[model samples]
Target: MPVLLGGDANVYGMARSFFEAYGVHSVAVCKKALPALAHSRLVKTAVEHPRLEEDAVFTAVLQSLAKAHPDKTCLLVSCADGYTMQLARCREALAPYYRFACPAPEIVQSLGTKEGFAEVCAAHGLRTPQSVALPCGAPLPELPFGWPVIAKPADSPAYWNCRFPGKRKVYLANSAAELEEILAATAQGGYRGAMLLQEYIPGPNTALGVVNAYCARDGSVPWIVQGQVLLQERTPEGVGNYGAILTEPARQDTALLTALADLLRQSGWRGYANFDLKYTSGGEPVLFEMNPRQGRASYFCTAAGANLARPLVEDLVQQAAVTLPVLRPSVWYTAPWGVVRRFCPDKHLLGRAASLRRRGCGTCHLLAPGEGPARRAWYWLRQGAYWRKVFANG
Candidate 1:
């Protein structure tokens, strides 16, 4: 049995993966009722959880859950950064009875922070945009990067704790004054963490690339899938989310894959990890950041025939190394039709729709037949609000 955290699309995909492979339902614990898992029949439990930041409470709850299922081995799966951090920090204490996977605490600490990750990339000779970290309420210094810089949080989980109306994860500042204004406003919104000012890469959403992999406990990656993002859900809430991903047979960047794999091995990162990158004018991919677990759009890898949850369960629960075939080339859809059409102008968009019915091509959050009427109604209600928001933005 797999115990998943978070109720977003990532957890929904994870639940489906386990059910498809092992025929066992996964228990999804979340703080709020997210349509992605709440409306899915695959999830056995979608109960609320305690505040994960409270380390003691989180550890106790995990212990309690593990003790409840004495006959089964429960593999803990976390899809959010905050939850991952808590699990990593408490891994030693819970190691006696519970089973969860993640990188060591030192590795998590270094790679989890934006500034720390940038430094790690620099040490490994990986390309990254010129970035500077500023303290809250500090005057913006003259930056060496170009104008129209991008400002984001150094620590996403902490930043998310600070509330701001109409706040996008990343903001563009076209001038020094604008940068300072954004920084001041962020501080005023209760975010006192470091603000990262990054050089904006000039390109459309198509320039984005992602690499998803499953690292074993020994730091070996059994499989990896790389793809190019054709579209992104640009709604305020979906700014950094992948919309439609295309994984062509020959589109894998060998050099990028090798470098990223080395980074994971050297950092001693275990479990599932994904990298977000953007290509520059010269076609060089620069590291944007690394997610400690599978991304929200990680269904792209699963839809391509390489479900990540399988490897985690096999390696951790079965205690065996499993070799998986390379994923097939396919297009993964997770956005509203209107949003996908708005962002992707490719003539072949209509032709690619045929794959939706095939095994290797599918969606992360589409309501299908055989589902209960209550779940179907919930799907439509959520879908209506999502598309309404996207259309309202236009």
Candidate 2:
């Protein structure tokens, strides 16, 4: 009986890769919008319900799969927060039919809200940006920090109708006036959820590292690996996401990993989760956020030698003792031309090109050769359009 994996198509790629590497048979069920003939068995379902409507869609999909393959033991892994929460909401109905791999519902809820995670970090004596939360339609609060403060929603797109229009969604407000203007615009755009007003911390040359781990049924952090983001491109409002390169774990990443493990243990986190952190000027790790599911950086982390998805699936299916992988130091670069041409037109772009020219990093576009030429062309075209949107707003 092949394992059943379902979620956003973005995650299907990694899940497919994991099963392929392990020589395990599996099937992928993805949302209808991003449809492709599943090179493997594919089930198309509607996965675009608003937060409140997600549980119904998930339950429908699972019930469909169970009826089709009664002999298979399903293992559910969700990539998006909305889907994860929906699964948790229907845990009683779904868990009996499938093995669900996710952090505790409370932990997922806590990490889903930026304000909630900040409070958790503060309670643990972890260093986080000073933040203020404002409800929708409320008057903008007085700017606590000067210009370039970080502004983002506390609940992401879970509760808000407005998607980050462009890079302006998450801003480095240069002045109180700029912050107020952006806040007012965000509120007027139907952003009714909580928003975070935080002090900006700069690390221009810094790489964002994600530390992901799988906790045992008893809540022990058994498998841990860290990977660095070589390149990142986000919308101004921070809603849009783009390609990233996975690289080998950095030597400086150990302390941060330890700190995060301790923090999650203290918070009673179990199952798979990731931490987004960057080093400060003094080499101290600063917590940015926690993702209680597989992250965008999961690809990079797996490419760097630790296949997080496999261990997660193994734990969920077999309940076997987990072990971490020994990863080598290597670099992965993503859609460099797009990133360079857009965000780093001057120094950053040139610097990356020069580095690649010097054989300092390995590069691969996410689109693979096995994909149809038409699909590949469409992907690049869509990618070009997204970058254009980012720059036009800039």
**What tens digits encode model 1's per-residue C-alpha lDDT throughout 1-394?**
7888777788877877777678888887666647676557788887676475688877777788888899988789988887788788888878877677787777888886677788899999998889988877777788888888999988788886777776777888898888777787788888888888899998878888888878888788767788788787767777777877877657889888888888888888888887899999799999888888888787777677777677887788888886674677777767765566666745364346434435436454455335688878877787678788877888
Q: Each model's TM-score?
A: 0.93, 0.82
Whole-model alpha-carbon lDDT for candidate 1: 0.78
Candidate 1 error regions (>4 Å) = 345-360, 364-370
- Per-residue alpha-carbon lDDT of model 2 for 1-394, expressed as tens digits? 3332334444544554455456444454444334322332323233342233456766776777777878766667665656666666787887777877665567778865677788888887788877888776677777677667887777664433464443243566787688778777776666667778887777742345567676766677767777654445644433323345445544536666677778777777666676777667787777777766666546555555666666766677777777666675544434445554445423653455446435744434354334556656666665676577566767
After TM-score superposition, the amount by which residue 97's alpha carbon in candidate 2 deviates from its true location, in angstroms, is 1.1
RMSD of 1: 2.3
Model 2, runs deviating above 4 Å: 1-13, 23-57, 159-169, 205-207, 234-243, 250-252, 337-365, 383-394
Give the candidate number with the greatest lDDT. 1
